[model samples]
Target: MAGSSATGLATLLPGAAEAAQKGVLTGFDLARRQGFPMLRHGPFGLIANPTSVDATGVHIADILHETAGVPLAAMFGPEHGFRGSAQAGKSEARSRDARTGLPVFDIYAKSGDALTAIFRAAGIGCVVFDIQDVGVRFYTYISTLFDSLVACARLGYEMIVLDRPNPITGLDCAGPVMQPGYESFIGRAAIPIRHGMTVGELARLFNAAFVPALAGRPARLRVVGMQGWSRDMWYDRTGLIWVPPSPNMPSLETAIVYPGTCLFEGTTLSVGRGTTMPFAYLGGPEVDGAAWVAALRRRALPGCVFRETYFTPGFSRHAGETIMGLELIVTDRQAFAPIPTALTMLSDALRLAGKPFWSDGGRTFDLLAGDGDTRAMLERGVAPERIVAGWQPALDRFRARRSGYLLYS
Candidate 1:
């Protein structure tokens, strides 16, 4: 029920990338060139949103509809709705697309027999997923993908995933692995909070690792992988356009810090929701901006700097009340460790904000953190570093298990 974590700016341009100049072509682009012949078999559904666009900024649904005999039977919207018009915790009502005149259904929070029934009623033989993910566990889009996989496996429907870049890059994994009994809509498995794999690769992992264990078997899965993407290439390096996957995720910088700072959504603090800075700005009404900034600076977190700041949100936590917090300045994308930095920030914030620091009765934080251990450890006066150290073994095991699913080197 809570949102994601992290920080970023809109000004960072994508022209300074390290990859080749020819640009990375997404699965949707390649599928279009191949004439989408697979869809010629009657009807298939697309799970997409405003972010499912080609290199020239044309929507994939539009292209498929216009292509001769493509057979795009229906469209599906995830958490925020198909056009991404709805805000957090809400979705657009089921309606027909004004442009393509195709029926659009809402897939958020629907699963099992209910979900399979939707696909069957649409008369879709296959389901294609093309949403861009930020590579964090609590983002919900991935959770929707996980649920869809289970449903498809149960109903014997084929599933195709059009792979996209991990935006935050897929070179590493960090944060706590979700423990059993701690599963929520935000986390459906025991993977690390930052699972460091693209959606296609995750689909493969889900089919082989999670689905069989829970759903009784695997789905018919196919992943159309990217042509030139590698584990080290960041979003800018992909040479693709940046479409905000959600309202708050305005740029790639936002995605980078998200796996960490997004934990604030579970707290009493204002995670810059109504401000132009959003996740980049964090604080609460009781916070001492200067002291909090000083405490965070002393941690010497890599790849980032912190500054004392104050703001009043037009919406969400502490709205219209001026609050104090820190502004994250990311100096080195490659060096900035988001989970550690965010844990340290939380530790400092809790210590400084006193008794009423937490909100939602702490359930939200526990769910996003993937278990009760993080919140429990923090409440028991544990150092942020010590808490992070406790997750090493589990994180290591997850990394090893996930390697088999990696599509890019």
Candidate 2:
């Protein structure tokens, strides 16, 4: 059944074979070429953000609004809001888009019946989702995707996902899968931390595997798959321009390390949120930069090097205070294992701190890691390699389960 569904999905993508012969073409680009037949289900609301733009840097909302016969009636913003004006854990208040004058709804941190009510209030027949995902499990965009799918499933609204590349190549599936009871917006479903799949592929997986259980039936979902994208190509290799998916995720470099370093958010350490480097920089007010660097270097983790550095973040965590730590530079992305690298860093930091490293009694860390076991093991001075090794069986199962949903070769 799954194989047939996969084949059906592949057939739905027009020009997919021809697209592979050319340059990378996003699902939105292909949909535009087809005159957006999806929009024929009129008065569709868009759930998008800054990253929802085309090859030419034009925002999809603007393009659809200008296109005659396209019923781009409403807009919805996720974590950072529609225009991306809000900071982390916050979203823009409900307002009208100045450009399109369309009503904008806030969907961040919202789920279940509340989310369904918002969709019902929009008076739209269908929902269009087109946000660029960085391919990490905890990134809120994917959470928004899951919640929106649940709401759509309940409301019987079809969701057309305009897919984009997983900025970090969709090849390596690493880190721990979220446990049953530890579900949060950061991880609504049980997938690995580094889920090596695109948004469209994930949409398919969610629709078939998870949504039926949550919404009592799968959402009506169609993924407009990308053309010319494969499992091994990274975002920089794609010709598309980089738009910061969120204020903190500034570049491809940041996206590369994000799957691991983002776990720092659960700790006392700063993930360099306000700094120019963001996830590339890790530090805290009390960290010993030289000692941390030496410890990391001793591990000699693959495909990366560390430089002792200091910086005063302009905003989140240690804001206006000079932090002592290191800048992680990935020398070879192919060999780099972000999850293990971060675990090593975390273990070393915990040893050096002489204090509790976790915030909120390590609950947040456990939530991000997808279980309390990881935190308990790290606290017990377990080796990062051993912790990573423990995850392999589960990771293998996840890879097998997700194989049918992969769109690229």
Candidate 3:
């Protein structure tokens, strides 16, 4: 996966990102070796979900237990639980690991004091976080990672992030930074909608900001960077397997369209959650499938084609009833940015249909995009290009700012 110089790096990637992953050492794979810099710590605790496995399907937890003589103090689970057995917003009930007898701590909803008790009981020397991030700001994995890091910093525990590929690559940044008042669990730090960096890179961003935010108590953070990982390379290139980070996000296709398709969730439409093809299809009772697709194409939005489709989701909103919507077919990733494309269709929906479309409000868009300005500009009769332009100044500044943390060449 690790290629040569920036020329070769850009050659491998599909876009402007001009670098490749290191060939010798991968972020997670490095831990498998005996005498790596990060492995010397004693009695380490793994804060990983199910996806924390090696290339050959070896679970990281099992690898460390077998290889290093490190005692497993306790396991920490993120939103979907340790094994990722539950769906979104759900986690496993506290249980002992049958094989290792390690106590599992739930950190998704228990970020503050309750979570702190678990860490204290575990008495771990370091926390290893190895989760694949999709490079979107609102995704909860980063939040879970953040809370864990914050806790580690507060108590002076070590944080070792085993880096993984950012499935959305890690170069092109889109949308505006989250404003002050809008900082929720979904949008805590000010970053674009599609932030192009790996979990480790995001940790770097956090550590730098924490140098100030922590008020002199910065996190003892160390990242074991990925080998053969280029910021521009997608999952298919790595020769490593792809694991579903959540129940709804089944495939890379689902992930690619997610940052945009997720916007539908905030609306009355079903973003294909209950069915097998979640985030790939969208529909609601009132949506005009053909009309919406046709009207959306009239603008000739780049890198995307809308296929008029219909479906009945097994669960979630608008379930058990067939509804109509457009299935986005992305022709070009470089030319086709999901955030801008989603906002355009939203604007067109508001323009073509007045109260019915507008009445539901842009709440879904607001939550999905993590900002009101983009959606607001569209509501106030702004064109998609202009709406995108309005946010570019901040977006550009962020792009330049984020360049400081680029891991790959």
User: For this target, which candidate reaches the highest TM-score against the unseen true structure?
Assistant: 2
TM-score of each: 0.93, 0.97, 0.89
Number of the top candidate by lDDT?
2
**Clashing residue pairs found in predicted model 1:** 4-262, 5-258, 5-261, 5-262, 6-257, 6-258, 6-261, 6-262
lDDT of each: 0.84, 0.88, 0.72
- Name the lDDT of candidate 3: 0.72
lDDT of 3 by residue, 231-348 (tens): 6777767777888888888888878888876776666667887777888787676567788889887878888888888778877787798877778888887687887887777766
Q: Worst ten-residue run, lDDT, model 2?
A: 1-10
Regions of candidate 2 where Cα sits further than 4 Å from its true position: 1-3, 6-11
Off by over 4 Å in 3: 1-25, 34-37, 211-216, 352-364
lDDT of 1 by residue, 217-324 (tens): 888877776766878889998889999999888888888888899998889888888687878899886678899899988888899999988877766888898887
TM-score of model 2 relative to the true fold?
0.97
For residue 201, model 1's alpha carbon misses the true position, in angstroms, by 0.3
Q: Mind giving the per-residue lDDT tens digits that candidate 2 earns over 350-379?
A: 888856688888989988999888989999
Better of 1 and 3 by lDDT: 1
Look at candidate 3 and give me any clashing residue pairs. 19-409, 21-228, 21-229, 21-230, 22-228, 25-227, 26-227, 27-226, 170-196, 266-364
